[model samples]
Target: MSDVTIQGNILTPAGWLSGAISFGERIAGIQGAAADPQLNGDDYIIPGFIDLHVHGGAGKDVMEGGDAVHAIARIHARHGTTSMLATTMTAPPEDIDLALTAIGKAVRQRGKNEARVLGAHLEGPYINSGKLGAQPNFARAATLAEVQRLETMAPLRVITVAPEIAGHLGLVRELADEGMRVQIGHTLGSYEDGVAALEHGAAGFTHLFNAMSGLHHREPGMVGAALAHAEYAELIPDLLHVHPGAIKTALRAIPRLYCVTDSTAATGMPDGEYMLGRHTVHKCMGGVRLPDGTLAGSTLTLDQALRNLVGLGLDLADASARVSTHAADYLGLQERGRLVAGAYADLVVLDRDLKLKAVYIEGERCDLNDA
Candidate 1:
């Protein structure tokens, strides 16, 4: 028997479709023509947004503990992010372990609230110091032993490493062989280095255009390489990470640009002083900036990214592919991200205006009408 039947516009797993999804606790089933649960005739159902590059939100850091992960995750869940990876910045090896350990625990343990923790994304410590956006330089470019230690800690679904960093690219292959997705980021590598690393098994790009090389005609740096490998690129389209026009150009070149908020502790907090580990980041204008005006993480939400990218005139199916569908396939998550029968009924119900109506973490619903 179905526990809850949500009608309205349901974003199904197959794609954004109009149907009723009935579930008991977690996703039990997708209610269609043959199910007891009925749906509203015309509500927009979208798969809950999946953020692969989020650090913290709702004034809590994921590194704190399961409580903190739950707190931050619940807040993003309100925004329709049914699943997320708790990302970590470049910190000491011990600190990274703490965060990853916490996330690993969260993934194994479920609560009555919060989005599902699919896995972890180590965005730093292994990254190049040169491309460290706001990560402390003290703990940069550790040896392969250190990288392997972090990789094997839990299930490292995604690791951000610099290809040009001392033998890091080789480790990228090992991680890939272990069925982990490796991304290239935080580096000063040339185009050739990025291309070679891709040949070594790097499947995606992390927060493209932030703390990485800019595209130059002659150099055609990492940014250029990502653009060249459109089918294999992930980008943060918050306008702060990459310019709007640049986002447009890259979208034209790259077919599979995914959107990530890369939000930090200051994300849901006010525009004042906020903590990002040992450093303090301030929200200025619409973006976060370090003490010296370097771009720290952002406070953007995925809903905002979808509206912005859609405003850029991309097709709806293609844009949907970039966020919900493509992100799932990228992480090799077979069950969720697409709305279909016998799949996890984790999704977001939005209005025609693209604002969130109600968000479902698994089958539980949270009203976002006030948000």
Candidate 2:
């Protein structure tokens, strides 16, 4: 394939560049590009944001068919996310299959809109029922055969399960060996049990401190263990999923701190009713929830998450690391999530005010303001 270069003020691993980069059609290196298109940078040029967890946006849910999925992807891409893992909340196994298979196809088809689909993050249907929060309790804990069937569905990247479930640890290791990230979340497990799963290769925590137990001096729950274990913790920084103070606290507690946006289908839309999995959540003021008003998912976009970080007194470099650099490291996507030479030309440009200016996904200008 021929190269389509993007020459602009660049941001490399070393730092911002005074010149630009030669982006190729499936970028290999500078020589990879057939032609170099210069994009003069009056804006901030950084690697495109990668969202590891998100449901939907732009008044559409990923669970809806093609149009909705593609539309949601476009909406996020315009806002600076070049790629994302389409996350599925707890739902029936049949629905899970449909969503997973559809997402796999979307990734392969390269979404009618430009945001690349990394894979799918099946956040439930494998979690504990007793501890279930926003997720429908009826959609909890599938049999082993049910969970195993997912290996054939999509590139299952991350699965959130409660380790305390019987036969869960075995399943955890099973998923870990299959190259899927096993994250302990939406559970009520003791510190020892949580640590044991981590020792057995459970590598992440989902939306820390929300929909889970709180830390205690005597009973140190999952939150306590996650805080104690510095190397792992992917907290959602939407401020609603967690309070601002708690967001600061978790960052200080964890050594390898990172941010994730558990954005629901209602993100970037007017507040109202929306469906997530088997339950319908009421949306208002950027928060999604169930009928009884229990907080479900969030209405946070990657842009808003970054803006929140800035508002919380974090500098662009530090905030960018948590949102972009650190998250890529956690997912072990060796080549993505950074602005470096030879890396994929997945980039986003923003104004000094931090508003999204444009985006390039794998060298294609998802937005063409500069053109």
Candidate 3:
């Protein structure tokens, strides 16, 4: 017998269809609409969100250690993220090492109350200081020895780099060769530099249009290259990071653009002080910002990101892909991000209005109503 079964208007790879998914650890079977007579017919069953870029939430910063990993994962899990990369910020070498060590431990010890930690997304040290955004004061050039050591420290699935940094284009090629998903971000690289990184094997863009070079009509910088080249870009659809008009523009230009929560420790918490790397961030006015008023990550979760896209008039399937499938595909995670017989039994159930009601990872439902 299956451990659990849920019936709803499910989104499948073929398209949205009415069905019931029965499962153990992975999906054991799929049943047609008629099979579940008890189904309410108003709930939505879509693949659990997989966030490739997320820093922390619930007053927990990833740099705080492995326990912070569980804290952050549990917070996002309550809102429909079943899997994610535990992201790190630009800090001193010793601090980054500590975060990576903690992330590696969390991957092995994850439980039902938390989202599965796929790996780490190191978002700093190798990035440019010109467009540091919320990152701290310790940026540096990419070094092969440091990256190679970090590679052994944890399962690094992605790294954000500036192609214009001295000797970084070659490092991008090397990391891509090793199957790491290299993304161009936090930089002042021009359009030509972005094209060069893509040519050297970079596969994605991180939190597009934030901290990166803008799309000037004449210069056509990194933003223009990302849009024009159709690179797999992760965007924060929190409605504050990029305006609705710019989001619509990105949607039209990039075919594989997806959503990520570059959330800070203030996310899911009351307005107060919280940490983003080494800096203290203020959370208020429905957003997070630094002392200088720079956008310091966001207070967004993936569930609301889905609602924002649909609110912008995107069809359900397309919005679903942005939060789940596109990021999974970019990381080459074949077994997750789909609600099929062979995929992991990870998903979220939403009410008719698209509000999250429940979340499940590996067939076990998380405590969404916890307060």
Candidate 4:
């Protein structure tokens, strides 16, 4: 027997259906009729978001280690993220080890009210020092032994590296061979370098146009390479990172472009200084930044990211895919990012204005009031 049922304009892989879904920890069945041809509706039951890159939330930084990842997961769960990667920053070896140890524990002890901690996205240490963006100054070339050691701390699902760094191109191929989703980022590499990384097994670009080299008509930088060659890439749709026009351009060029929060410790908290790895960042004017005004990360949650995509003239279904489906597919998660029988019962309910009404992770309803 099903443990719960919900009625709404449901988003299914086949399309929208006006129906009631029955479920336990996994969906049992759906029974209902078709919705408007346009798929318009005030009430929506869509697959919960899967964020590939998340730093921290609820006033806790992932670098703090310990039970901090649990707190971060709870905050993102309130914002409709059913699953996420506990992204770590460019930091010392000991700090990274400490953070990943905690992330591994969180993955094993996921709370009923928190989002599933899929694994870690190490966005540090193996990057270009010349183009650190908001990352700390600890960038260095990668070694397979070091990466394998870190993976022992937790499943390193994704690792961001700069192709131009000595030996990293080969490392990208090696990591990809070992089943890690390698990405090119924090790079000053040229267009040729980006393409070489892809040829060598890097699967995507990290945060697309930020921190990496920009496109130029004559030069055709890393962004140009991603636009021309990548099948999947992540972009921050917070409107503060990449301009809407630039986002639209990417949409036309890349087939499986997805969105990520790249959120910081200030997420879900008031304007103030917070730690993003080793640096102190300020959250003000709806964005997080360093004191000198370099865009640090963001305070954006996935639910808000969905709204932002829809506002950019995309239909609700397409917007939903960018925030949920694409990310799930990118990570090879089969039972997530879709609403259907046999999939996990992870979903979000939204009212007319796209405000989050409720969220469920693995069929357990989250207490939004406590967030």
Candidate 5:
């Protein structure tokens, strides 16, 4: 790879300062910014965003498999995400297997300008049907045999399950033992049930406050457990799926509350019909919703997510951590989600207005115009 140098006010481990980053593939060096009398400090550089939960973008869903992975990666790259987990919705066993197989293939053969496919986040057939928010018809208790089979098929990084389901606590323990992140979501689990899942090794909550129990002053359901106990939780900050006040509450209560797009095929496209697994969804009025008006997913991109956090009165550094650092730590990826020497050359450049100006993935610049 050829050497590439970027000059601007860069956000590094030491904090935001005038600097230049020079790299080939991995980051080679970060230095004081080049002397330019015309420098306005309007241009800024930050580590590329990493999303833990995303289904699709650019009119393709993960359930479509194969090239759909690349399409999603390329589209999100245009929006400054350098890495993400291909989140799968609840579906038939064979459909799930196919999606996993396709994701595994994409992981092994990622392109230069595409975001890295870290692994798969199985959002489950092993959840409560009562809370099946936009998920297709299949919902069942996870079996040991099925879990074992899934482990062998692909790189499974996260699994969202309902601990209240019969025989799910043991399943959580087994998945956690295998180094997979077990999360609580799509369930009717009470506060005690959520606590028990955590006791058995569940790491966090999926899209907190959505498809899960709410915070009752007396009952303290899933939302309460997440805020009161869990180390990490994913929040959709689109202002549609969750209210801003609730976001503030979670931010104050949880130690590490990161953002996830939970974006669907309708993202980055004109308002129209799109696919969310076997279900058809409509994208209109800047949101994706089911025929019956239930929010199917979001049309949010991480760049906009960062902007949203900043708009919420957070400083740039803190906002950056929510979109990148927190999610990276949750996934156990130490080298990603930060701008530093020896890390992968993944970064985003924004203008004074904070609009995306450029994106670099592993030292290669992605063409935003492609999508």
Candidate 6:
């Protein structure tokens, strides 16, 4: 196929440029001049969003297995996500296995107009049951053998573990040594426990300040540990999972903080009930929640995540990094997040209002209307 070229106010790694980017499956060339005030326009071209924690979208839950992951990938691609992890919920081993098997297939057989499935993000089964958050009551302890078996089912790129659990600290070290991105979440672990996990190779915190312990002047729980020591972590920027004030505080503390959707099956669907692993959650009041009114996940898409960050007083470039570049960096993905030459031709086009106008994955334009 011939090269496809797009011209706009391009967001290059250096900064914004008034130029044209040419690409086919990969970026071939970027030609442009410095930003010209006289030619300022409404159009902006930025790298596609990368979501590290994604549960479901478009009426499909990841735990449903089969074609569910495919539907979720296509729906998220419509909202400017070029890639994401197939995040699973806490359930029995058989359920988790089914989800991962489906995710592995999707990763290998990425379909047309679908966001690339990077790998499986095992978010449950091995966690502290006391702080289950929206997770089911199936929390258990981690074992290297079990994790190794799961890895064989799919590429376990990222896993959430509660270091306070028995033998979990050592498991964190082992997984990190093996190159998996271990994250702290769904735990009642103390501040010291959080610190020890970080020292033992826990690379990040999952949905910071939500499922984990909170920060107090005396206790300085997991949230405090993250604020004090974490170099990378993810926050749900839907403006609901975390308050704006708290999000601001985290922004000041963590330099490599990124954004995630934590979206549920109700995403892109009308207000209703949907399955989140073994539990059925309600989608209402702009949030997904359990019957007891606990926040389950979220109804956010990445484009809206970008807008929410900008609304929270972040500049457009900084918001873009949170939604795209930072997550890519966290995953050690060199080719998917930025619009520089030699990267994959994955990107999004937006108007001055930050609304997605078009999306491209591996140089193929998506049909936004189909979303």
Please rank every candidate by lDDT, starting with the best.
4, 6, 5, 3, 2, 1
Backbone clashes in model 6, listed as residue pairs: none
- For all the candidates, what are their Cα RMSDs to the real structure? 3.6, 4.3, 2.3, 1.2, 2.2, 1.1
Tens digits of per-residue lDDT for model 4, 1-371: 34899898899998888889988999999988888634555589999999999999999999999989999999999999999999999999999999999999998889868999999999989999999889999988889999999999999999999999889989999999999999999999999999999999999999999999999999999999999999999999999999999999999999999999999999999999999999999999899998899999999999999999999999889999999999999989989999999999999999988899999999989999665
TM-score of 6: 0.98
* Model 3 lDDT tens row, 1-371: 35787777888887666777788888887776432312455688889999988889989999887589888999999999999999999999888999999999988888658999999999987889988999997999988788889978789999999999989999999999999999999999999999999999999898999989999899999999999995589999999999999999999999989999998899899999999889999999889999999999998999999999999999878899999999889988888999888898899999878888889887888898653
lDDT of each prediction vs. the true structure?
0.75, 0.75, 0.89, 0.94, 0.90, 0.93
Model 5 Cα shift for residue 164 (angstroms):
0.6
Q: Candidate 2, 75: how far from true, in Å?
A: 1.5
- lDDT for 291 in candidate 2 is 80
Instruction: Please write out the lDDT profile of model 1 over residues 111-145, one tens digit for every residue.
Output: 65577887788887777777778887744664656
lDDT at 260, model 4: 98
Please say which candidate is ahead in lDDT: 4 or 5: 4
Which stretches of candidate 6 lie above 4 Å from their native place? 36-39
Ten-residue segment with the worst summed lDDT in candidate 1?
32-41
What is candidate 6's lDDT per residue for 243-265, written digit by digit as tens? Answer: 99999999999999999999999
**How high is the lDDT of residue 336 in model 3?**
91
Better of 1 and 4 by lDDT: 4
Clashes of each: 16, 1, 0, 0, 0, 0
What does candidate 5 score on TM?
0.96
